[model samples]
Target: MQTITWQQFEQTDIRVGTIIEVTDFPEARKPAYKLMIDLGPLGIRKSSAQITSLYTKEELVGKQVLCVTNLGNKQIGKYISEVLVTGFEDGHQNIVLAQPASPVPNGSKLM
Candidate 1:
């Protein structure tokens, strides 16, 4: 794997956001969800996460998750993903969302 300097890593705008909406994305080749997150000062941003194996739509609402905000927008079929929902892969290859240990203000930057 390639290594990056700490300064370069800091350039990544990882922040906290609350999931306000979740919907199924059938258009995606892989199973995923369409999410609308409230990023406080950043406003609402949309994301597409392939976390269906470990998460349900009903359970995701109101959950605080880590987001990479400055990745720019990505087009997934007709859906426009505005932010990246950060996560790691589980042993079974399911996505495990990266989240704060405690509740933090939405849009709070990672330090």
Candidate 2:
């Protein structure tokens, strides 16, 4: 694996955000959800997450998730994802969202 400096790690703007809304994204090539996240001081941002294999829209609301907020926008079909909702792949290659072990203030930087 490639190694990175502390500065490089620090430069990554990873933060906590609450999932306020989730909706179906039929236009996406892969099954996914369009999410609206509340990042507190960072304001609300939109993202597209391919976590449908393990998550449902009803279960996603109010969930606090880690987001890479500075990656810039990603264009997927007609959607413009404003942030990157991070996660890990399970044994079945399904996504399991990255999250805090406990609740934290929104927009809190991962240090």
- The model with the greatest lDDT is 2
Each model's lDDT: 0.96, 0.97
> Model 2, range 7-102, lDDT digits (tens) per residue?
999989999999999999999999999999999999999999999999999999999999999999989998999999999999898999999999
- Judge candidate 1 at residue 33 and give its lDDT: 98
Clashing pairs in 1: none
- Shift in Å, residue 91, candidate 1: 1.1
RMSD of each: 0.8, 0.5
lDDT of 1: 0.96
Compute the lDDT of residue 109 as modeled in candidate 1: 99
- Each candidate's TM vs. the true structure? 0.96, 0.98
Off by over 4 Å in 1: none
Candidate 2 weakest ten by summed lDDT? 70-79
